[model samples]
Target: MLSQLTYLSFLAVFAGIPLSILVMGSVISRRGDHQPVRVQVGGVALMITLALGYTIPWDSYLIARGVWWYGEGVVTTRLWWMPLGEYLFIVAQTVLVSVWTFQYASVADPTVGHSWRDRLLGVVAGVAVGAVGVGLLLGPAETFYLGAILAWAGPVFALQWGVGLRYLLAIRRRIVVLVGVPVVYLSSIDRIAIAQGLWTISPTYSTGLTVGGLPIEEGLFFLVTSLFIVQALVLLRWVIARWG
Candidate 1:
């Protein structure tokens, strides 16, 4: 119960990131300053908003459509004025937004300062992780599961770009982003995958496993995939900084 509260708190902070950033951007833009911090925070907010923008509305639609039944046979029709689930869901929505915000922070390592090679490596790492996620983790692709996989996993990638850019910090970081991003991303997504049990063999390539409705490897896959994205974005920044 306490753990759930903590989780919800994280959600609230993450969900509010965009709003916070927007306010910050407005203030900073007024100052006529283009500080990287402000720009970065703004980018973070925009990315997060763009990323999770779809889920909240869709969830609302589902709730309204009577798609989500309930837990313990209790339908929370209202919590002080708003529907109970809706209220909880608003919190959930914020959390969903927040998770992606912190998750995608810029690579913190000094080594990831700015370099083309490292950034490119991050891209390679992200792609590799994404591929692995589509291949080994999910255990084969069934006609490109983007729409399905993306619904849950997209947020992670939104934030992983920093970590992915952090790829150049070391071979260890590279490997982690390459391998770990997908794992984390996939796991985050797999639980909500709402698929048929663990070992969700995507209709081919054999060998699969599942736990609580998603593949075991998926969580780890998400982690790696998100990191790679961070890495690639870092690289892009390096290029633009050099050329521009």
Candidate 2:
């Protein structure tokens, strides 16, 4: 059974520790950085706001629809249909990714031009993914979780890609590191949470697929959300550079 303490402990261990270390490192290494602390903080704050606004309603719907649920005593309170802890998770995850993004943000020079070909290719790919998700959503109950994730995230993916796909690709290695580390770490923790009955992904709504005991849908959820944060931050930096 999941207690509120267990949930908070997970956040403390997985998110809190890394965030503390990163902040300390930034404070110590603040010399000669392209972005000032104020700018970095402002960018992160903006991303966090966007993340919460975009995610809360979708997550609430997921809980209400029985796509997932928490263990007994796992959450002590609710905001709309989500636990308070869940909201904190959203903020923590956003900050983690956004901070990591700034750490590696110096690698890419965003002034270089991008071709229309790349933009079209990315948009088409996003549309295709969304189409597949829509099909799954209409097919059967088992794919609802996966479908909802893709359907919700695909358009955002397309928009980001259309705006700055080439720029992102130029900084692909940095983006990979920033996005991959947290996604892998958080997904691992999420796997443990599910295994320990901290929360349950509804079998009826999810495809019966697992990656080393973690649901595939859960993995995809983390992956896309992390990507969203990284993409937005990287592009925002680019915009500021080009026109700020």
Candidate 3:
């Protein structure tokens, strides 16, 4: 069962392969609009690095503290409290989201511009999330799952808004659709995985809330992750255009 769970984990990550191929291939087909695939590829690499760098420690802490764990006999290998599939999940999700955002952004053809409105919105958003995150951290220990998630993701969300808020604001609609569609789609997949006993979350450590059998924290995880990848792409596009 453990090996089977490990295989299921592998299957989840492997799903990204065909997803990436399809989205990236579409971008290539419309190269006239999505020219400079290098930018998209470069951005994907960068986000993957950043996502893994951040998520590994965050996830490691959770696993170490028993906030979540794979079902019995479900993990075949471990690297410092994390299953190998987790690392792959970070990369796979980063690539999947980045490529999807890039492909769609190309189609949207948004005019990127920085403005005071953008900065203002960024600061406001950052402060809001940071405040919530801090509040959660200072709250009950049983809320560790929520607190940890917000504590980590809130700052990143705020930072992206502060740095690339305008670019994101410029492409807000696309980002919404890009992030929204996948959040819902992937949330369902996640619910199924949980139901199948691929992994288990501690109800005591969570709000015990379920959306389609997935803990709300788990849904927020995907939501924040998608947002991070999309915003990272926006920031990368700006950097490449400015410095590349």
Candidate 4:
């Protein structure tokens, strides 16, 4: 019955359940820090809005191109080219990472000051990754999915780096914990969903590569998206600290 769960129900179980628990825990833990909580909550709201706005169009385009598709009876409704469940996923994932990031932000002392060298390094690295993605886009067809993920995510990574590479580096360990846990956990669930026939990735668009039966592209997809959410929340907190 678990594998038989509809796509929406699957998210309700995996994403919704954990989100409710984490949100309650975050609120209880931060109850004493009212101002910071307000700021973080505001930041999370903004990130959620931005995540939905940014992801919907891109995901719809991918679906239209047959990069991926949902299984029969797994989805009950469609919005444009995406299943409604996919939209919920965008919101759920952003909030999940935002709440998790707050756990670190509440206790960690802010890293002050910035360096042009660090900023430049971050920009160069982001651009380099984007370049690689562009190259893959022009190469064999199988690399297209990976290429699209990198290309879509690279510029945002650069922008975040440009704003707070120094700060991000200072809190590197926290970043790892914030981004890593979600990516691995979500990737595992994603593997399960694929196994259950909830959705199928087009072999024509994806690299025919697997990590423990999960596609490498799927892992990278979660990796970059998690990084985007975590980095945004951390930087937003940093900005509020400096200017708010």
Candidate 2 lDDT over 91-193, as tens digits, reads 9999988887788666447566677998897798788878888988888999999999998888888889988888888888888887888889889989989
Which stretches of model 3 miss by more than 4 angstroms?
1-14, 17-28, 31-33, 107-112, 239-244
lDDT of 3 by residue, 1-244 (tens): 3235553454555455568676769756874364476766777888888888888998998899888888776677789989877787777777777767776664433356667778778878877886787788778876778878777887787778877786776677777898997688668767866877888898778988877678999999899888888777767666566555
| Per-prediction TM-score to the true structure, in the order listed | 0.37, 0.92, 0.86, 0.93
Model 1 residue runs over 4 Å out of place are: 2-35, 54-70, 73-147, 150-221, 228-236
State the RMSD for candidate 3: 2.9
Summed over model 1, clashes come to: 46
How big is the positional error of residue 5 in model 3, measured in Å on the Cα after superposition?
Answer: 4.2
Candidate 4 local Cα displacement, residue 83, angstroms: 0.8
With a 3 Å backbone cut-off (N, CA, C), the pairs that clash in candidate 4 are: none
Q: In candidate 4, what are the lDDT values of residues 1-244, reduced to their tens digit?
A: 8768898899999998988988788667764263465777787898888898888988999999999988889999998889989999888888888777777554434547678988888888888888888888888999999998888888888888988888888888888988999998899999999999999999999988999999999999999999998888778777766776
For TM-score, candidate 1 versus 4, the one ahead is 4
Model 1 lDDT tens row, 14-102: 33554466456655554323225554555445544543454455445534533323332233245333245445433443333333333
Give candidate 1's TM-score.
Answer: 0.37
Alpha-carbon RMSD of each model: 10.1, 2.1, 2.9, 1.8
Which candidate do you rate higher for lDDT, 1 or 3?
A: 3
User: Candidate 1, after superposition: displacement of residue 42 in Å?
Assistant: 1.3
Q: Give residue 140's error in model 4 in angstroms.
A: 0.5
